[model samples]
Target: MTHQRKQIGSGRNAIGDFAPKLAELTDDVLFEDVWNRPELSPRDRSLITVAALVAGGDSDQLRFHLKHAKDNGVTESELIEAITHLAFYAGWPKAMTGVATAKQVFTA
Candidate 1:
């Protein structure tokens, strides 16, 4: 499947300045290629990405992905439920952090 390059955030632009090749790979390979695979819908990919970010306590990336998740059709209730369900396995602290991040994303 082919996809238009996604404008994820400033990180890609910053990386592109220093390492254009890496940035190309990120934009072309990761986002365009892998993320656009027809096997998974964008919403499903958002759910998986959000869960990974939440599990790893990656609030910085989580912030971006949360917005993407909502744009991809993941509902507020679904995001809350995912975080709540992950708390037991990923840790309460991480889930708590996710909740705070979610609030910021949802409110914004």
Candidate 2:
């Protein structure tokens, strides 16, 4: 038996026309290859990705990942708690910003 990874076209929808190569790489390499690896489930990947974005204070990307994380079965409270916990290592300001971003995503 074999498992098939789900297909996603977020990259092309996001930036295919502006940067074809990046879009293709995002669609093929990141989403198809990296994200679909058997080792980690999509929910786990979403959590890690959200943490990275929060640590880097990448709000723009964080917005999307926040929703993505939720869609992947991560609860809103879990996400909030994760961000609150990240404050210690990732920095207070970054977590504060993450909170703001999370608030927007949660409400919207």
Candidate 3:
């Protein structure tokens, strides 16, 4: 399962034709190398990523990470709680958007 996730080519599948280098880097470097680093579990990384994405008001990417977070074992309530907690630090607007996006992800 770990090895399979590492070989993912979501970057390629999404934009390889227009951005080959980025695809390679996203697949080979980001996913394969960085994500596979053993220090932090994938669940930890996914949660961190979801928080950053929410804080940054990056809903586009957050959609994917929300799903990834759940796949990594983060519960729906946990995600909502995290987003709610981020409101104090990440601001109410961003947290609201995160909740909205999370709703879409979890329900779908």
Candidate 4:
């Protein structure tokens, strides 16, 4: 089955003016290579990425990944469970932020 690739960010439109190289790497290396790896499905990658973003308290990135996660077949229930599970290990504040970001993504 062909997996639909989710647009993770604004791509060149967001960074190309000031950081062309970074934009290129974000598009070519990160998304094209690492994310497109065949071993792990995009859904699995979305789970891991969202969890890591929550653990890092990186809500900026979390918003995009949360939407991408849903596009990749991750349900709202699963995202809720993941954030809830991470609260203890990653800290309550981070998980809470994740939940807030998730709510926005899900509702949007």
Q: Tell me which of candidates 1 and 3 scores higher on lDDT.
A: 3
Q: TM-score per candidate, in order?
A: 0.84, 0.93, 0.91, 0.89
lDDT (10s digit) by residue, model 1, range 1-108: 655334343436768789888888878887777787778888889999999999999999998898888888889999999999999999999999999999998897
Q: Which structure among the candidates has the greatest lDDT?
A: 2
- Give the alpha-carbon lDDT of every model: 0.86, 0.90, 0.89, 0.88
Q: What is the clash tally of candidate 2?
A: 0
After superposition, candidate 2 runs with Cα above 4 Å error: 1-7
Report the Cα RMSD per candidate.
3.2, 1.9, 2.5, 2.1
> Model 4: which residue pairs collide?
none
Q: Residue 97: error of model 1 in Å?
A: 0.5
lDDT of candidate 4 over 12-99, digit per residue (tens): 7878889999988888888878888878889999999999999999999998888888888999999999999999999999999999
Candidates sorted by TM-score, best first: 2, 3, 4, 1
- lDDT, candidate 2, residue 95? 99
lDDT of 3 at 100: 99
lDDT of 3 by residue, 56-88 (tens): 999999999888888878899999999999999
Model 3's alpha-carbon lDDT is: 0.89
User: What TM-score does model 2 achieve against the real structure?
Assistant: 0.93
List residue ranges in candidate 4 displaced over 4 A: 1-10
| lDDT (10s digit) by residue, model 2, range 34-72 | 988878877889899999999999999999899888777
